[model samples]
Target: MSCCTPGSSRGGNSSDAAAVPGPTWRQNTTATASGETVQVPVPLAAGEFDMGDNFGEGYPADGETPVHRVALSAFLVDPTAVTNGEFAAFVDATGYVTDAERYGSSAVFHLALDPSDTAICGWAAHARWWLEVRGACWHRPEGPRSDIEGRRDHPVVHVSHRDALAYCAWAGKRLLTEAEWEYAARGGHEARRYPWGDALAPAGVHQCNIWHGRFPVHNTLEDGYLTTAPAKSFHRNDYGLWSMVGNVWEWCADWFSPHYYRRSPQQDPRGAPFGMARVMRGGSYLCHDSYCHRYRVAARSSNTPNSSSGNLGFRCAADDSSLSFGDPAAPQ
Candidate 1:
């Protein structure tokens, strides 16, 4: 986890690592039927967008291990992530209990030190994270101290894959498949490093709200944010999607297998037959070059679907035309 940044490229020297900006918020222009229910309105994201790397600015991880081609018809997607307000609405509407809430705690990065000692301090955790912190659920981001009263626009955190599944079921949408996610992220272009082209950071333009200067100890705020920013803080990709590379590790629908790419079909390969963990992509705001540079488009990561954290969240997706999930009569 410390060795990978969400969007870092290992090799394949790129001359255009400064072409496009990172994902920023896109407008929620699609209108929805008026309803008192707290529902996410998804829009038709039509056209066949390319998936996987072409410029060699991505990592070769399982699932993303192979650089394959896929042609997907247009679909609909939520303009932004599922927000605190939205999740609250879901919980209110249904007695759904998130895994984090049911377990009574979740993993937190334990920055252990003697406080008086400077020898064990570093951005990259010298040891393993996933410390079991009691009362560490989504509502209480910092263990009963934080609340979502003023963060309605921020993406919801500490939700499990099952929770996301429930939300999708109730909202008349579903989570984006890994291939679909990449296609939407790329807009219409072949993969470069990010949702944008081959640029890590464009000159004079701060793309994603990543960290700057010395991490942990010193933060320069070059991206106008020390922590996470509003969902719309940076520029959108060609597909008009925001923060596709960073902010949180979005959970995809596919089960993970590091060797899945080796057997990935070119048409619409989902993932392995079965696995314990699900795929997490786009890295997160915690991403740093000195640590996890996994924000790259082709990079793949896996985690227990039930685990949650401050640096993880998700969005929703819908279908375009009259079809959903390849079935013309699929329910919306």
Candidate 2:
């Protein structure tokens, strides 16, 4: 696991397997009362763009170097991360279970926990800020006591890579490739530190959700968010995409390899063929420059496929043929 995010080490028990009876569940494409889907994907026309970090600001070990040109076919991506309410609809329809729920625990930031809920079963040795809290699933974000009653619009967390794939399958979408993710996140910008520009906060404005104070200790909430903000709280990029670099780390559809960039294909690179962990893009709300400064557009990280955390979530993407004018999940 990366130091920025903790990965789950526990395996699912027999009881966990028994809880979810089937291997696959029904897909939920239900429309709203007004006949609109929960999300509308944004389309990016086919083009070639510079991929990876040219500046030396990123961690070299994570393979953010050797900036290369990448050509990609047209694709559609979700404007924002998947919300708790949307995930709830899928669970309600298919009775699908998340990896965190299956494992009976997930990694949660220490600061997000309340003083009363002391059910921390484990901790990341290198980064003590992460706590393996029991019953920390999608609905119960912080733990058993915490619920998504008023946070339905917030991006859903505690979803593993497999769980994200399950959601994509049910929604008739797929996870974005690392190259595609960077392309959409760039939002037509070239070699810019962030989706907006080089400045972290231009003209004294908090553009996105990130740590505003001391790391894992004092979060002044200068950006008005200690945890995650609303999925669409901040301004969109040049391509009209929201929260592309912060709020939560998004899962990508590629196996992680720190050295992949050295041998990456120039045309729509799909990442490594096989690996121990998968790629995670965009930093989360816990990101602090003093510690994890991976909030940049080209920054990358990875974790085991079965691992999940409170600050980890994902969005979906699809090819042009899979989307239509009347498709609720497609771009309007």
Candidate 3:
């Protein structure tokens, strides 16, 4: 299911009837991981790659129409979504308050909700599984009684797009542009459904953490998770980016536009000039083919800049100029 409520932008769409092969380029460098912050050194092919899903391969979303080509510049991105530990470090260093904290409330998944508090919480009118609770922030993802505890390695959720920007600014980085995000998520693959490939479970091996059994009810935990998994729990894509498809919905550095792809620039497109909701990509653990099949690499989503939820989080990216090129193996 979509992370944001209605009025948020939908996924990018395409008019192309078939998948287009991506341009080929020599790989300059691959990604590397460190203790907690895993930065991937992406050497983009830099020419053209199919940017949206064709009719039959992806879910039916009007925003995901008009399959088109988009070019992106080479950039460095975090291999994994920012973890709670990393966010905590940023908080400790800057004493910055997140939007969820400032607002004293956030949207939480119903499965993660406390049994007794269910009656008091408000549910999303469209997606009843989403519960709005006071005191639900990144640290207290499930609400007041919840804490990071052993989930330090898990992707930090309940972070608004503004909160993600603050973290990026503090780290001297920026959020990935929607094109950049799709490029990185594709992970050197061309027109594939996921970072790995078209098969959701290639060779019957679960590659990412996503919903199992059913959505909003009875998650069998067959993927070894009920909610969010550790940021690095799954196999990294060709670019060594982890959890690019499933885990949490990542915020992107672009405003929402249903037809942005129609008029988007051919070179390093920046997304809609201005809009109310910001772009978000990657389906979260709540995704199910029966409901939201947006976990596909080319799929897209969006939410208000200040909207925060248990399934929402982000990673950081830096321009190639921002990091030293001395050691390719060194983390950014």
TM-score per candidate, chains pooled = 0.76, 0.91, 0.86
**lDDT of all predictions:** 0.61, 0.84, 0.75
Superposed model 3: Cα runs more than 4 Å off:
1-47, 55-62, 330-332
For candidate 1, the TM-score is: 0.76
User: Which stretches in model 2 have alpha-carbon errors above 4 Å?
Assistant: 12-37, 325-332
Return the number of clashes found in candidate 3. 12
Candidate 1 C-alpha lDDT tens digits along 53-152: 5555444554454566666656676656676767776666666677667767655444322233322222323424334445656676545545666666
For model 2, residues 182-265, the per-residue Cα lDDT tens digits are 999999989999999999999999889999887878999989998888899879998878899889999999999999999999
Cα-lDDT of candidate 2:
0.84
By lDDT, highest first, what's the ranking?
2, 3, 1
Query: How many residue pairs of model 2 clash at the backbone?
Result: 0
Order of models, best TM-score first: 2, 3, 1
